[model samples]
Target: MSIFKQIKGFVFDLDGVITDTARLHTKAWHEIADQVGTPWSHELADKLRGIGREESLDIILRAGGKQDAYTDAEKTQLATAKNEHYQRLISTLTPQDILPGIPEFLHDLHEHEYLMSIASASRNAPAVLERLGLTQYFPKIVDPNCLHTGKPNPEIFIKGAAILGLEPRQCIGVEDAAAGVQAIDAAGEISVGIGDKDVLRGATIVFPTTSTLTLANISGRLKEAA
Candidate 1:
């Protein structure tokens, strides 16, 4: 039987999985790094995937060898600056930015009466969803602003499931980052990874992209895993 047969809810990550905001986030981080005279690269930005803003800032500061140079208040200011840049860039987002196949999948899930929630590490998730016309698809969104820790901690996924009124085992967590997969796994939920298998090692199933996912395909994978 399909494992999804028992699943009542889904927790989805926002950035790379539902949209292309990951690039925008990378751009914002790069801008911040440049302003601080830090050496920034795509490789460094990749490490920020699925991490919260402050934590991501910490990683960037450490990578630039300025971790100890900044006080807590200074770090907060840097993080805020990065977010300002990100918000300015994302202000132009529209419904057209929704990833391929995601709208159809969301509609299908809604029609099927499967409860869905967003478990993103981004504090700007609500604004992004609204801009993309996707706010109606998810009733619950775990607030990253309130979180002390981000992905790989399972707190966001756990909070998502709770808001959906379901147990961890009753929901599936979907993500496009390694830290996100680890979070889902740690939360005792099935993980559907939307990225390379090599990077999404802890995922229960891995899909090359969201465009390749379907309810039927997910069911099949669940059954096979079972």
Candidate 2:
């Protein structure tokens, strides 16, 4: 039997999973780093993946040797500035910006009657979903704005399963970040990673990209694992 047969819900991460907006986030963070005279690199952006905006700002601040220099209010202001930059960039987003095979996959899951939710660390998840015309696919959106903690903490995924009226083991969490995979594992759910295998070490299954995944492939793997 397919493991999916035992699954009742599907929880997805935004940014790198459903869309290519991670690039926009990286660009915004880089801009913030430049503005603060902090040394920044793609590696630093990678570290921020699946983290909340404020936590990401804290990471950047620590890297720039300014974590202790800023008060809580100042940190909030910096995070807000970065979010404004991200908002301006994402304002142009549309359905075409969705990652490869995501629309089809979502449609397939929808048709199959799998309950779906978006569990993202991004505070702008709702705006991005609306901009991409993808809000119809998910009935629940667990973003950082509603959660007290971010990915790798499992609160978002746990809330997603709760909203779907399912247990963690009855749901599958799909993600594109290492921290997201960790969160899925920590939540005791099946994890489908959509990025580099090496980085997504804890995922139950790993696909290099969404383009390499399909309903059939997922079902087959679930069957095999079962």
Candidate 3:
């Protein structure tokens, strides 16, 4: 199977797919939960997956039973603080963090002239891509910082497909969160889920991990689904 024969374009999500930032996010969430004296578990963290930092904080706050409503400024402050912590932790990111087969997988898509873009909830996604020398891989980046809403809304994925000059079904979305999968489905696009199996429920196809994805593999899977 050839990717050139199977898909028109590719739309990728940033955090858990292109970069190993999910672990950093999880670590930061644990720290926040500890400091706020709220219990944080994998279950709760999974619940926060694929949403913006502000939204994640709001979810955490509600789970902790905090009824006092914070102003937008207060919420922004918490998200900013978490980002500062995450940035410090991610400063050591290298090409190795690009996942086992992802760089080659991207190259294969590029060689096949598959249009590429990113639809990510992280405001810092572009910076991460720039740091990893992947800015050239994605010309259209639909990030939370540039959008009014994030995943499960379909706005980012829809925008990314538009920028790629491809129809939603002609393009495939690579995501690692439940919200992202739902977002792609809501957008009427084909989505490939790329992390824990449970995160892939609504995705058209689920790859256990990035380590197992190659363009050839993707093409085969896409055909199987079709």
Candidate 4:
């Protein structure tokens, strides 16, 4: 069935969709898990994708069979530490760190004057965009810290559309994580997935990677949906 929308704006996820901070996140989480004696596994890593700070820490604790071992205060401290670590790792980011085809895609969108906003779960969305010199392309970014719920809840995506002065039916939400895609779908926006098809089956359309995410490809998909 067709699920296309008017698509007046684009709602973006920062980490995996704009750049490669996903690895930095994983590394930081891994360090935290090691310190907390969490049994690190691929399954555990997969669960962390698109997860928020507290939820990610909770998952780590659960994997270590230490979910009840830490008090809420202790968990807060751990989450803070992980954020610091991730920040240090992302400090190396520059405009050069932007993922493949991102510049061209953003250029086309900007030239077309399509409104754009960031709907990422990361509190570092602003900093990352500034670092990559992409802040000019996005005038609005939903504050993760202000959100009562993260991805898979659609709150962030909904906020993104609102900031762009558009309804959910007038925007396309692009994401690289299943949880993020689910949020976009739930928000009633067209969802563009940038990863494995099976993992992102919930997306309206799935691309293998950002390298293949050219504006032409996106337009083709949108036309087909129309």
Candidate 5:
């Protein structure tokens, strides 16, 4: 049995899961950090990964020790600057940015009659999907921009399952970030962590990368566990 055999729905995180846009996001953050007169260290950029745009901005600003340095009005100004930079960066995305076997993985899921959806913390998730020509694969999307609460809270994943008309137990949430994996667990859903294994510490199932995973293989794992 493959994990896919038991999963009625597949919930995915956009950036590092289906695409390699995490590096692009990090680059955008670094660019904006420089403009904000803040240093952009790799460690700081890593912390912002897999979170909402507003949340990322908050992290960056706070790390810069400018949380209270700017008024709400000024904070909005900074946010606008960051968005502009990120938007510009998004234009650089090509089909090549999509990870290996990702499109195939999605297609396989669809063929298996698994409902697919995107549940990302990024407000830019919709646009990212559009840019990657992957908008059609995901009929339902739940982004922080569409929710009051973000990841690491589980609301987003819960809402995503709701939109897909599935129970949390029927869906497998795929994520590449620690916060995202945590969110899935909090939602009472099975989580399959992709990419770095360290970040998926508590994840019940972990894969090094989507390229090496197959629906059949995952289904086998699920059956073995059962």
Candidate 6:
């Protein structure tokens, strides 16, 4: 049997895959960088992709040559401040904020009866989805609060698959980041990358953009991979 034929569900990463909250994240991080007197650049923001908040902050601090400046307790406060700001930014979101074609593709998946859940590193997944008016499409989000490790470790994806009552190999994991693709691959799932093939080269399949992520297209690609 084709590995694709065995798929029963989908595990998704939130920030880039579902919407453009990545810009909001960058904005929040920029604020933090200013507060900490760090140099913020496009390159620095790219490094933060697909990682947990604390890890992202560490990279930012390191960029400013302040990696060892703060104690763990202080780092926690910085992360908390960034998250609060990001949450506030997302609070204004409406259904209009959902990325192109995502709403339609989500409906297609729902029509096909595929189980879906989230494996986002963001602790604010529920709030983000609710703001995007996509809360109905995803009910199970791996609690980032409970996970000890982030992406590239497979813990979140593994938890996401289990919540959907499927094995890792029985689900397709979708992401827009290299680390997320690595996590899905590590979890033994078929990985679908939704942007920049070069950046997401670890995926089992790559689509140029989120608009291309439809049921028919995904099914065709899966058949080829199978």
TM-score of 5: 0.92
Clash total of candidate 1: 0
List runs of model 1 lying over 4 Å from the truth. none
The TM-scores of all predictions, comma-separated, are 0.97, 0.96, 0.91, 0.96, 0.92, 0.97
Q: For model 1, name the residue pairs that clash.
A: none
**Candidate 4 structure quality by residue, lDDT tens digits, 91-128:** 88999999999999999888987899999888998888
Model 6: lDDT of residue 216: 78
In model 6, what is the error at residue 11, expressed in angstroms?
0.3
Predicted structure 5: lDDT = 0.82
lDDT of each: 0.91, 0.88, 0.82, 0.90, 0.82, 0.91
Q: List model 6 lDDT by residue over 68-142, tens digit each.
A: 999999999999999999989999888888888999999988998999999998989999999888999998999
Q: State the lDDT of candidate 2 residue by residue for 12-77, as single tens digits.
A: 999898998999999999998887777988789899998888889888988899889889998788
Model 2, poorest ten-residue lDDT window?
142-151
For residue 226, model 1's alpha carbon misses the true position, in angstroms, by 2.4
**Which candidate number would show the highest lDDT if scored against the true structure?**
6
> In candidate 2, which residue ranges exceed 4 Å CA deviation?
none
Stretches of candidate 4 exceeding 4 Å from the true structure: 1-5
Clashing pairs in 4: none
Q: List the residue pairs that clash in candidate 3.
A: none
Q: What is the lDDT of residue 56 in candidate 2?
A: 91
Q: What lDDT is reached at residue 207 by model 1?
A: 93
